[model samples]
Target: MIMMDEIVLFNPGDSIGNFHDYHEAVQTAQIYQERHTESGHVVVVKSDNGAPSFDIFLAEQQLDNGQKNPSTSKRYTISKKL
Candidate 1:
């Protein structure tokens, strides 16, 4: 399988966007955060490191009836404040 690194803008049940470029994703996340004060958002990066991507987690959660198991995929959050 081909592994492509990606940045995903996540908000629990909703996903804002996915970006291949880090800077663009960060800028977009920051802008979204600035516009939505009460909403919680996080910027997640897909990497080789052993962490679950927010997007993948969401999909898995849906299949598992809201259960979370981190060992299934690889991703890490860059910023929860952005």
Candidate 2:
């Protein structure tokens, strides 16, 4: 039997953070996306031994000044993994 480890990497363009759990990393990424206008992403990698890992990419939209014209802020989840 073989065991595979899952690694989650949070990329906010300029910096990167690592997480052991997928949901926690995604949650943190969402928080960052809501707090800043800059675009950010999360990558999940699953691997075993020294073999190449499979990656899943998720990204958030970049908010602009014009999009904030409304009185209330909009909250939604926008992510795609491949």
Candidate 3:
């Protein structure tokens, strides 16, 4: 399993643009999915490395009961440093 540190940090409601390579795209996707695997107050993943990836809304759940609230579709846009 890939470690959390290895996965790039993403936020909700971010926009993604063109991707440079397929590996970057795949990595972004993997991290996006991982963020949703857990319950309760999850953060969406976004990559601005110009990598093609999916944008999923992370829903926050009750810490004690694990009940998730309605997920708000937040856009995540990642940017690269030129």
Candidate 4:
């Protein structure tokens, strides 16, 4: 298998967009999430080995239980630089 970092934008209807650049993927996700506020889309960034580095979600959602609440989405940061 080819080894490289990956970014995926998970949109409504379980549709996904694959990307190699994390920032680009995140931007796309943000745009989609903003445009489709009712869709509840999310973004995932992974390392070369498939370990998740970042999980971006719609606002007012919980990361632990995958539940929606009034709190902002939780963010995980592996490093200062992407």
Tens digits of lDDT, candidate 2, 1-82: 9954422332233233344555665566556556653554443433332443232334333333465343332222223232
lDDT of residue 61 for candidate 3:
16
Worst 10 residues of 2 by lDDT: 73-82
Q: Each prediction's TM-score against the native?
A: 0.44, 0.34, 0.25, 0.39
Runs off by more than 4 Å, candidate 2: 1-15, 40-82
TM-score of 1: 0.44
Which of the two candidates, 2 or 4, achieves a greater lDDT against the reference?
4
- In angstroms, what RMSD does candidate 2 have relative to the true structure? 13.8
Per-residue accuracy of model 4 over 4-26 as CA lDDT, tens digit each = 44322222222245456677667
| lDDT, residue 6, model 4 | 32
lDDT of 1 by residue, 1-82 (tens): 9955443332343356655666666667677667776665444444334443322222212222233643442334443334
Highest-TM-score candidate: 1
Write the residue-wise lDDT of candidate 3 on 8-81 in tens digits.
33333333322446456545545655664553333333444455544433333112222243243223342221
* Rank order (by lDDT, best first): 1, 4, 2, 3
Candidates' lDDT values, in order?
0.44, 0.39, 0.37, 0.44
Model 4 has an lDDT value of 0.44
For model 2, the local distance difference test gives 0.39
